[model samples]
Structure formats: C-alpha cells, structure tokens
Target: MPEIGAPHKVTHQDGGNDEISLTGLSGLAGESQTPLAHKTSHQDGGTDEISVGGLAGRQIFVPYNAKIADINEADTNKHTLNLETALSETRKIIALIAMTSRVSGSSVFWVYPNEGTTGIDLVATLRYGSTLIIKDATQRLQYSQGFANDDWDLYCFGYVVEI
Candidate 1:
C-alpha cells in the first residue's frame, strides 16, 4: 500500500524497478539530458525559460483577431489581410479559426500564405467556423471568397519565439 501523491517504486517482470514521482515520470527511452525546471533571472531583464518534456524554449502565445467587412464580392482577385498592425513580429501560426457570415448558394473561401496569384493555399472550403492547424510562418495572409458581399472574421492563435 503506497501513499497517495508519493513516489512509488514500480517493479517490472524482468526484475527491474524504477521510482516514479507524482511530479514527473521516468523510464522513457531517449529522454532529454536536461531536467524539468523553471529559472527566472532579473540581472539582465530577460524572459523566463522553461524546459519540459525534453523540449526547451520560451512559450508565448499571442491572440490575433481581424475582421473584414464587405469583401468586394467574389472576384478573380484576392484580398490581402496585413497582420502587421495586430502582430508586430512574424510568428508561427499554431491554430487559426476562419468564420464567415451565413450565405446562400454554394460559397467557398480560400486563404493563402502569399500575395498575388502564386502561393500555397492554406485553407479552402465552403463551410464556416473552420479551424486549421498550420505551421507556416508569415506576417500577412491573403483571402478570397466565392460569393459576393461576404464578410470574413479571422481569429489566430500564434506562438512567437524569441531568438
């Protein structure tokens, strides 16, 4: 009978045992050499760094929201949404939610990573309230609608890494 919230010694059938604690678990293969810890320093006024699960980096998420009204109906041209005003630096897009007002008669929306006619299409669909998990890095995004007079709302949750 082991105590709750205490380190328990786990025995293996092969006559091996390892101590597992409530805070952390061991016995995993190819684990990181660095221990899980958080350090704060005020000498140089730097950000805090945390090492968890064998990964070390500064974890920061910035919420981004942009709304475009009356997107010039569905045309052959694409509209650009500049994120410089919302986010100062270029960030990795972790997750993005694209929402559009309800429209009738088969409407589709496309989100691109670059401007102009040539670039990778990040999203393309006719459904509203769609979520996309992307790893593309950029400061701006381009969008186009299938129907005329459709409003688009973009919500982005991005992660910024400090060099």
Candidate 2:
C-alpha cells in the first residue's frame, strides 16, 4: 500500500503513542512576500494569553526567555544563536524547534539570517530526534552546525514575514 515517496517507519519501541510522518515535497517555495499572519491577545505572567499565529500573523509575542541557543560539543557554523538583536536583526522564519533533554549530538543543524552571509541559504535543518516543528516554506534562515562538547538545548520559533 505504501511506496510512493517512502518514509513511514513508526518506531513505537513498546509504549502506546508513537508517530511518524514525512508527507513529502517541502522543497520550498509557497511564494513569499512574507507578511500575512497577524492575530493577537495579551497577559502573560498573570495568565489569560493566546498566540495562535504560530508564524506571527500578529500573535508574535515571542518571549520564552528570548530565543535560547546553546550548542556545545564544539559548535560551528562559526557558532551563532545569540538572537534578539530584534531576532538577530531581521530575517527569521523557523516557527518552532524545541528540543530539550539536553539534546545530544548526531550533527547537522542550520538556521541562519545573520553574521554576514554571501551564499548558502538555509533557515532550518536540525537532526537528532528531528521534527518537533520546522515552518520555513521559503521564508528561509538555515544556520547551525555540529554539537558534542556542550550538548544541546536549542529553541526557535518563526515569522519575520510570510505566513
């Protein structure tokens, strides 16, 4: 029944809820001019909050202690993730990539928009457990590399434009 594009190997190990998905063709390009996803609501520490924009259609509250980034085990890609120069000074579109459990390395992570580039356009390409979320439809921003010396505990959400 399955064999058109391949990549359906749900590994349950033994428990109950184990899922797998790879629905193909994210080769990018949904057409970009960015902007088109704005919604908003307020109140945080006092509760009463909602931010359903996911890609910043207006719900762009984004303050999970401000975009954490730590990649040890000898970081590379010239070592980045110092975010919040207003989200690394423009150009962001990740959506979500929350990996915690200290995230050990298997290598391969990219989500870039800064540090003066010339080529190599990427906005997301993480590995390890993989796919907690990856929004880039061509909003683009891939810039990350290896990890081993410090382990990992990275988080990133998106939308600087393009819903």
Candidate 3:
C-alpha cells in the first residue's frame, strides 16, 4: 500500500543550485489574526460555497465573483493599521497567528481574540517536526501548570502578508 500524504512531485536530481533547495542540514542560512469578521458568502460557480461573519456579527452576502476583504485590519486592532504602503505596494496580508505545543503522543493548539494591540490575545503558528501547530499567540497557554509563563512574548499584531 502507498504511504499516506505523498508528495505531489518527487524530484531526485538536484536542481544544481545547492542554495535553492534546503532539504536538511541545520545551522544553515535558512529559515523562514483576525477579528472583525467581514462576513462573506457566495453561491458557487456552484462549486464552492461558504458563509463568513462580518465585523461585529454583521451579515453580508458575498457573491462568487466578489472576493471580499473580510478582515478589516483597521478595526481589528484599537490602533490604526497603517497598511496604505503595503496596500499600495500590493502585498498579501497575513493578519493573526496561532501557536501550539506537542506532547508525548499528541499536539495542542490555541487561538486568541484579535483586539488590535500587540499586547495580549494574539494568535501564532508553529511548526514542529511534521506537525503544523497553531495557537493563541499572546494568551497564556493553559498547559502543564509548570509550563505557564506570565511574560509571554507578544506576537506583533498585523498582516505580515497581504491577503
């Protein structure tokens, strides 16, 4: 039987550029939100249909042809989201983030409310081994009692990449 989650395309021949592909080897030059629900819904070309909530629970009918900016960065945070530069430059906005932790045999994730300030209740995304973990970026994780920290690093609240 074939293994689950197979790669779309597996290439063995090195692309010739060592820096281009980072398969392994650590210590190497490598590496690499939300709120204000902007309700969006659409009648498929009739293939995909989804109903999303708008800011403060407002209902909006989004059509298939219309791609809405559901997450209003300006309203997401109490402070202003100076996205004019990014918006003008045309960037994908990645708002909030989520965080997660892994245990002996299971994983845990968390999500927080996005209220603008980079203080508390943020979200984050973490990657461990083969697991993609997402959790509350700023909220104190309620895990093992000893693992909790009061001074959690505040994950900057904003869209990293324009959506």
Candidate 4:
C-alpha cells in the first residue's frame, strides 16, 4: 500500500486481472537503452548539455486522453488502477520507474489527467533522476485494443541518467 501523501508506483502486469504483491519495493522497470537525453560537460564548467533519464532527480510529463466516465459503485477511474496486473484501456499511460524510498516500490503507475476528460492532457510526470529504461506506447500489460483501435495518445520524454 502507498503511504499517505506519498506518491507510489503501482504495478500492473499480465492483464487487467491476476493482481500480485501489494507490498515490497523492487528495481527499475523497462529495458536499458541508450540515454535519450544526457547532460554534457564543459571545459570552463560554465554551461553543458543536460540529459534526462528516468525518475531520479528529473521531472517527466506525459500527456494522454481517455474517454471514460466516472463510476458510482467502484466504477470510478480509480478502479482502473486497482488492477495490479495491468491498467485498463482507460489508463492511457503508465509511468514506470526505478526503486526509490519515496514510493517504497519499483514498478509502473497511472498518470491521471488534471483537467476534464476526453481530450489531450498531461497524463503523469516522473520526478526523479534515473536512467529511462524504456517506455511503452500501449496501455499496460494486457490484451489492449491497440493504439490504432483506441482513443489514446502517449507523450514520453526520455532524459539521460545524471551520473
């Protein structure tokens, strides 16, 4: 369970079913790849190229859209996250990250929209400085209807891991 007032990484795999461990923190998610954005050093130490990686000391903003209606009896979008196995079609993006103390776990979580539903919106933003392993364009690890078939959009920003 996520600590009150603390942001937690919610893990969802397999499908919208078969929930797994609700406790324990692990390592980062996704496969390792070349740094998408990295910081460069200068000789005079004046200014340098800055790269962004996973959530370690960086902030990532991912926008998306989901035409889902709020539910009454466990029908709210919150239920979409209840599925530990995988997020539902409603969840457009899943922000995966490395193990950290803030969330007490290593996994992926939902990035909800801050404004009205059914339009382009900022899904989630990762606030950490770690190497971005990989990002998925699909909706969680389930029998997704596919991007071409669904009404969702993915905006991922991969930064270089600050050494």
Candidate 5:
C-alpha cells in the first residue's frame, strides 16, 4: 500500500542492523571486523535506514578525539572546501579521499554554509578515482567545484562525538 516516492527497504534479523545495506549501495563492504557504523534498531515496525552507500570502500574508524580537516595544496578551480575541524558533535563520515598522486579528473559536490558565503544548491556527486569514500551514515562532507582549473588534494576523515 505504500509507494509514494519509493526507495525504502530495510530488512534485519541477523545481528540486526550492523550497518551493511539498508538501501543505497554502490557495492563494497569487502572486509569487516565490525566498524561499518550505521546501527539503528526499531525491531518490529520499521524505520532503520542507513546510507553513505554502504561504506563505499570500507574503513570506518573514528575516535581519538578527531579534529583534522585537510587539503594539502593546489585548490585551483572554482574551489570550495573548508573544514578545518567543525564537527564538535556530529561525527561519522568515515573518510573522504582524493589526495592526488596522479589522477586529476577532479569532481566533488556537497555544500551548505553561508556567512563567509556558500550555497547555490548542489549536493552529492562524488565518486572518482583515488578512492573517495564516505561511511558510518556520513556526517558532513562540504565541497563544491565545477571543473575549471583542476588541482586538488582533499581529506575529511571524521570523529567528534560526545553527547
């Protein structure tokens, strides 16, 4: 009887919601020792959705007080990525890659921050070479570009939860 906008299916019972597909998976969760993050429990009725495309590439480890936002250099283009640590509480975006060793077909999207100015409605268009991953139901991955100058070095691994 449902089917309004569709796209909602979460089945669980085997270890119940241990973070491994509730919908949105591009394919990848290769190895695990329990650290995929995205554990929700409702038990009987339903409402336990998990995303970040099933940990994309896997490696969800964040907890050492986490406070490291980086971009090595060369942000040439219509650049827009600034996160020198601004997640004092919402942590779980495992890892956002692209350190640029050789591949430079750069492309990234997702933005929401204004005061220093930033916002024109553009979201989630990542997934390029050099393994760009994001997991643990994701937290925040602020970025924006349109490909004009081409030069990047991004890094936004996360962990800052205590509440």
Candidate 6:
C-alpha cells in the first residue's frame, strides 16, 4: 500500500486503477515538485492566479465575428455585442475587419466600448472596406452608424483574448 500523500507506483497495466497527484510530478527544468499555484504580477499593478502548468504568460486567441444585415438609416440605436458569452470573463480586441456592402457618401460607423458613448469618444471609425489593427480591452462593444436613408450590410471580424 502507498503511504498517504506520497507518490504511488502504478502496478496495473490496464491503466484503469492509477492514482496520480500533481504535487508528485516534477516541474520543468527538473525542479522539485510543488503544488500547481502561481501568482503573476502585471505592469498595470494587477495580478493573476494561475493554476495550470505551462500556461503562464501565454495568450489564446479566440475568433469572433458578427454580421448586421439590412441596417437602415433609421436604425440609429446602439448595437451591443458581447465579446464573450460568459459574464465573468473579459476579452481584449487585438484586430478588427469591418466591411460594408453598401455605403453612402457620408456614411460612417463608430465603434466604442460602452453605451451612451457619442461619436467623439469612439475607439475606431470605420467606413467602407476598413481594416483596423488595435489593442483594446473590453467585455462588450457598441456600434452605431451615421447616415440617413441608406441600406447597408455590416460584417465584422476580429480576434479576442480572454483576460
């Protein structure tokens, strides 16, 4: 029998009765094993509690896209898009590609981080065939357009990183 809290040797070849503890595994660089808890500090005076192995300072990119079709001039309300479905998670937008199928001569689209934000406080201004490369941390996005009596198809493509 194995001692309590000690590493156990696997004697079964079927791999069905194996017991393993993360504390028993050797860390990278052959260091002594320890519990999988790491705290990292950020430049912005924030910290993250990481629990997994080999996941520190690594970013995973999640693809995001939204299509707003048949947007008319009367549709002046702020359209809100949630970058992540989960409310507890926040994501950073790294890049964006905004395309419009039809645009009037004076048409313009504004992208912002919050509701009730006017065009003056926009994070990005997009027109027909616009691709923007930016890094902004936000959980939700607000989109609105400026024009009248025009039908447009808006397509947005971007990638986000969960913070």
The numbered model that scores best in lDDT is 6
TM value for model 4 = 0.19
| Model 6, residue pairs in steric clash | none
User: Per-residue lDDT tens digits of candidate 5, residues 1-163?
Assistant: 5467653442333345445643543435453345433443343334464344545354454433332333333452333443324444453444443332213545543333331245333223323322333323444454444454433444333333312
Tell me model 2's lDDT, rounded to 2 decimals: 0.41
Least well predicted 10-residue stretch by lDDT in candidate 2:
120-129
- Clash pairs (backbone) in predicted model 1: 73-148
In model 1, what is the error at residue 140, expressed in angstroms? 1.0
- How many times do residue backbones clash in model 5? 0
Each model's TM-score, in the order given? Answer: 0.39, 0.21, 0.15, 0.19, 0.20, 0.37
Better of 4 and 6 by lDDT: 6
Candidate 4 structure quality by residue, lDDT tens digits, 46-110: 35644344345443443323322221221113222222222232333434322111212222233
35-135: candidate 2 lDDT, tens digit per residue: 54343233454355654556444424343333355556454655433343435534444444333334565654544343335322122333332333223
Residue-wise lDDT of candidate 6 within 18-103, one digit each (tens)? Answer: 53434545656355455643432332234544455556444555544666344565666666655444222355554445555554
lDDT of each: 0.47, 0.41, 0.28, 0.29, 0.38, 0.50
Q: Order of all candidates by TM-score, from best down to worst?
A: 1, 6, 2, 5, 4, 3
lDDT of 3 by residue, 1-107 (tens): 33467542333235433335545735544443124323433243444554343333332221122211212121221322233231332433324232323332221
- Name the top TM-score candidate: 1
Q: How many backbone clashes does candidate 1 have?
A: 1
- What lDDT does candidate 6 reach at residue 32? 47
Question: Lowest summed-lDDT stretch of 10 residues in model 5?
Answer: 121-130
Candidate 6 regions exceeding 4 Å error are 1-58, 63-70, 73-75, 83-96, 103-106, 113-139
